[model samples]
Target: MDFYDKERLTALQAKEEAQWITFAPFVFQATRVLRNSGILTTVEAHRQGITLQELTEKIDLPAYGVRVLVEAGLGIGLLVLSEGKYKITKTTYFILHDELTKVNMDFTHDVCYNGMYFLEESIKNQKPEGLKVFGQWPTIYEALSTNLPDKAKKSWFAFDHFYSDYAYPEVLPHVYAFKPKRMLEIGGNTGKWSMASFAFDPDVNITIMDLPGYVEGAKGKLEELGYGHRISFHPGNVLDETQKFPQGFDAVWMSQFLDCFSDDEIVSILTRAKQALNPDGHIFILETFWDRQRFEASAFSLQQTSLYFTVMANGNSQMYDSKVFLECVKRAGLDVVEDKDYIGVSHTLLVCKPVK
Candidate 1:
């Protein structure tokens, strides 16, 4: 190779090495905690804002260990110390405490931490051992609630602020805005979507259906939102033989619900949804899709979808190519009326009607 070509190759190699060196810290869970220690620091810092000695006393940690953690956090831009006291930095505040940020820190902590440790074994065996660790997929919820209650609370708060209360207002101005008098939210967790829809369109009434426990949670949120009168709950496996829904729904909204099933199950859901819909009623589906043209998508989303599908739920759910999803809709005898991409993340709003 020429001298110029050799120089360019050396520069590229240095850049690649630097990228790995930067991200290498993230591969270890300890580094991840340090990266996101704002919450821990802020609470401790507030409790001990008087001085480092007080902070050390309040947290009940060795003074030396506290100093080490604090210093490392400062280097990582997560904590700022001035006048011999520490506080959460600006980067940490938004990243750790913001209402709308999409970071799933708890999910990262629990699921990925437990699962990634077994990545090599999983790859070798061609199966996920994380499910074995948790005993079952439903147990993930229990473990999440038990182990990381505070982080889970914040995670749900983020969901409520962004996807529930705020999303409808942001989306209503678009063309084909839906204002339905009767709506159903399948697998509606905590009734965020139902509450938002009720709030946005006063005349709209919503029913949220989910597993019994989640249904109860939804009811509580609805009551808190003062939407108890207009929102109702049905608690049962909607996919089972005993599944039943009241008739005459003007629109059915399944947000992040359908992807948790196999193609056959998805078809069954469509059929049941069709049954619940009145004439001229519509069905709205919100989920991510996979498009090969997008390189960012190719890098992560497809693999994540496959892994999530394999382990998250029924071991069958996944992100489908748009064409595959459309085919499933057609097989269910639902006509695709509208499909709109939400963001570059393959999220889209699909509107469908029953084929007559």
Candidate 2:
């Protein structure tokens, strides 16, 4: 975080960064086309690099189309020209091959691109103005089940799953460490975590609490998988505040769930988690706090993602700073017993109990 505190770049260098913002939309689309049109992949395959005419012949586009994109790619730092040939740069290779980069790009392109135009209005209005691009919904969460475009939905799930898929393997051990026989999973979207739970522990019973839209679908598939006896459903909106968490769970788990609501809502949710918990039960909050990240780039990515929350998500929530998030924990009258950082890709798990 300190790396961002001082003015690290010279006036000239700072101006370049500012210019990148000015042309960001064009750069984003151009780089995306280069990746999607297979221009980078083709250049990558040649190894010795390929000439402008060779790249034109290899790709399906017309000569002028290829020429324009290739030219843009060179300026965008996605390509380097040397000896009359263009080669994919390290940045381009990541854009082409890295799973994280691919997911982020797709999520941005399919879900966030058009909606981002409403950011200034969203911030001023204190609402998700961009979500109107999708449908009439207060937030994108509700729209996820019913209204999102097909490609947007696919990219959204892929983006969501990519992070959790990596985190699950590392997170499961900690959840099962207590040998909890019953667990409550809040915001159990699509039963991805439920499925993971079933595989991780054959004996533990899980009660999934979520919006009505997500819970029913998860219930049916889980039941069809013959997990009928192990998984139960509780569909209710947590923001209603009138409805409380179901009681008597040995461990209450929330994974990538809390960041969906405002800080006040988090305190409300965690307070309910405390009330629902058995005397010795611990609440496990799995979240990505930008400051907790091991690398500055990872931190930067999460920080940028907070804007999506502002303009597209609930408009009230965001990727939290650890200090701000922890203050919410204290406000809920919960004490963090174990603060574990760097869990899997970019998560920090806070183990909390009712304040003593």
Candidate 3:
């Protein structure tokens, strides 16, 4: 209750809502079904509202199925029944048409929904037991690079890109302000940010350091874009204790990358990045810190995403609070030169210099 207004408390209502938490999983599945089964879209198509019979005929669903889903939708406030016809509500409009909602829904269903069943075990064991739903990989990153299911992989990348892609335009100016001739991008998954940097400034050369699979994928993309000569690849696992980061870069960039690691690993990686920098070099770290979010919903989304890391991704990392992340930076022999918050969506940009 530290963040809540005590005077506005409604104990009974709160208790009732708490009880309903038991039904959240069912409710989520129902919402997904309503959206995917065309019931929501069909109702939206008829702005004047549509009868149960009309919905059944139009969606090719049985009357019974239509009746149950519509009733559930009404109970969930996603639909309203007026004179025996169902109308999509304002909330339903976002659910049906919002791009963020679509990406989140698909991501939840394909990537996290089923895997979440092992959350309890994952929490108890400090391991991603839920990841067994897919295959036995230490982290989802391995599965992503190797043999992950097609739909899940698509949803995962979509979810990852949807949030970070918007921030790139804003970030490019800050990176280029340093007038870096050679920049090293760590954990450069799929090379999206590297490609963006190339587009932003054609003269700046980029070296992508990441897992071998990702390096190969990035190489293919750069080659296809005829940017093969401008970008280079260093294939290695940053988490490996003995691995040393390649040196002599003017700047290093990590976009939505460090959050994939625990605090200890973050410190280790940053320490290596510190070593890899030139005397006047800088390192840019971009992350969506839960504590730095402008909106409560953004913070809530990040908090929920921590569970995905716990149960599906790596079982150890989380969306860190800004204070905790900054402490890690300090421990790694770096000093924060600038802290810029509220960059496209919930991201915060931390510009750090090696401690001299």
Q: Rank the candidates by lDDT, best first.
A: 2, 3, 1
Q: lDDT tens string, model 3, 248-273?
A: 99999999899999999999999999
Residue 266 of model 1, lDDT score = 88
Give the Cα-based TM-score of candidate 1 against the true structure.
Answer: 0.67
Q: Taking the tens digit of each residue's C-alpha lDDT, what string does model 2 give over 16-74?
A: 99999899999999999988899999999989989999989989999999999999998
Pairwise TM-score winner, candidates 1 and 2: 2
Model 3, residue pairs in steric clash: none
Best by lDDT: 2
RMSD of each: 7.1, 1.1, 1.5
Candidate 1 vs candidate 3: the TM-score winner is: 3
Q: Clash number for model 2?
A: 0
Give the higher-lDDT candidate: 2 or 3: 2
* lDDT scores in order: 0.63, 0.90, 0.90
Candidate achieving higher lDDT, 1 or 3: 3
Name the regions of candidate 3 deviating beyond 4 angstroms: 1-9
Candidate 1's error at 234, in angstroms? 1.4
| Clashing pairs for predicted structure model 1, backbone only | none
Give candidate 2 misplaced runs (Cα > 4 Å).
none
> Residue 73 in model 1: shift from native, Å?
10
